[model samples]
Target: MKFTERLWQDIAPIYNSILKHGFVNELMAGSLPTFLFQYYIQQDALYLADFSRALNLLAARSIRTDDVLQFTQFAQNAILVERALHETYFSIYAIEPATQKMPACFAYTNYLLATTSLQSIAVGAAAVLPCFWIYRQVGKHIYQQALQENPYRTWIDTYAGEAFDVSVNQMLAITDRLAEQAGAAERQQMQDAFRISSQLEWYFWNDAYTQNQWQV
Candidate 1:
């Protein structure tokens, strides 16, 4: 089996939990409270901003020119394409610009940034892969189940769309290629990074659903 396939297997339980999470189920039913959706989109915007930075860090560290170009384009899409979707939601919901990252967003993004900046390129790629892979999975799953008149239709379509699929495929290919060349120790680190990031994906959605805030 390919490394990406193993990564998926490792996180199968978490992905199942995500699919069954109340936020996702309510989203598909189009009955999610607007306030929860609003919180998600706002936190997501903050995430993409930092996500783009992590991609750029990988681009700078990438040894292969093609890998560099791919990471750069990925960063651009995080800023341009995904953020455009967030902006549309902001306008529709009249969500104010988020002033700070919520705890989950802060932790997740910092993990990506630290992994990409300080770790081997292979491990960094693993850290960021869950976001792309899991979002695509959830998006497609929701698209298949989403109500016809769902308020979050645009959000679902964006992640499930052909364009997003192309980028995700590229990332998966990059990760597999990196994994093939990595030493055993590095591959273990990659798996650990991938697992942690996958868990964080679950927390991010749950945090939005709970309207998580800094208690201090």
Candidate 2:
């Protein structure tokens, strides 16, 4: 099996939990409260801003010119395409600009930034892969099972659409190529990074569902 397939297997439990999460189920059923979805959109906007930066960091660190170009385009799409989706939601919901990153957003984005800046390019690619791969999976799951008249249909369709699939396939290919070139130790680190990010992906969704906030 390919390295990316093994990474997916390693996170099967976490992915299952994400699919079972109340936030996802409610969104699928069109029963999620507007306030919760608004909060999530706000936090997600913050996440994309930093996520693009992390991609740029990886782009800079990539040894292969093609990898560099791919990461750069990925960064551009994260900012332009995803942010456009957020903006549509913002206008529809009248969401004001978010002033702060919630705890989960802060932790997840910071982890990506730190890893991409400090780790090997292979490991950095691993760290960011979950965002692309897991979302594609969840998006497809939701699209398949979601209510036909769901309010979050746009969100679901955006992630599950062919354009999004193209980007995801690119990321998966890049990650597998990197893994093929990596030493055994580096591959282990890649797996470790992918696992931690996958865990964080669950926390991010649950955090929004619970409306978690800072104690201070």
Candidate 3:
């Protein structure tokens, strides 16, 4: 079977949990979850922009072809996708994209770019994996709630649909493929980067909640 098919297989448990409880059920039913959702919407755009800029800077430097190509492609796609959704997210907060900046967001973004520029492509790819995986997990969780409520039908349906599955599956497939191609050193770098980025993601969302003055 294709890597994507296998990835979906591997992620089945987490995916199902997200579909069944996290997105839809846990999200809308809990005040904390709603605030968390709003926080992410208000903050992710700036972080994404930082991520994009980092990728572009890496592309400007000398790097090995294969890994760089894969990461670059992913990062570029991320920029375009983020931009596509920015307007909708921004409208929710009555905020414009030009009006936001967080130091941590910049630091994370710069770290990613610097990693891609100075380290192996495997390292860069690993750094980005947490973001993709968490997104899939969160979307699945939120969708479950939306479906349960039958409100926010578009958001619920979008998360519940094949498009989200396809995107998450694609990232996992890439990770699997890269893991096979990477050597021990590269793998270690990737692992460390993944852990760090995952933590950063958590903090990023936490900051959103705090900064937004959201109750709960």
Q: How many clashes in each candidate? A: 0, 0, 9
- Encode model 2's per-residue lDDT on 1-216: one tens digit a residue: 999999999999999999999999999999999999999999999999999999999999987899999999999999999988999999999999787988899999999999999999999999999999999999999999988789999999999999999999999999999999999999999999999999999999988999989989
Off by over 4 Å in 3: 1-27, 30-39, 54-73, 98-100, 147-160, 212-216
After TM-score superposition, the amount by which residue 117's alpha carbon in candidate 1 deviates from its true location, in angstroms, is 0.5
TM-score of each predicted structure versus truth:
0.99, 0.99, 0.68
lDDT of model 2 at residue 56?
99
Assess the local accuracy of residue 121 in candidate 2 as a C-alpha lDDT between 0 and 100: 94
Worst 10 residues of 3 by lDDT: 17-26
Model 2: lDDT to the true structure: 0.95
lDDT of 1 at 137: 97
Q: Which lDDT tens digits does candidate 1 get at residues 50-89?
A: 9999999999998799999999999999999987898899
Superposed by TM-score, candidate 1 places the C-alpha of residue 72 at a distance from the truth, in angstroms, of 0.1
Candidate lDDT values, in order: 0.96, 0.95, 0.59
Candidate 1: stretches off by over 4 Å: none
Top lDDT model: 1
Report the lDDT tens digits of candidate 3 across residue range 1-216: 643344345445544544444333544554434455555555677677767665555455525575457456656766776665656645654654444555556567777877767776556666766667766667666665443544344444554567656765665766677668878777666767776776666556546555533244
**Which 10 consecutive positions of candidate 1 have the poorest summed lDDT?**
143-152
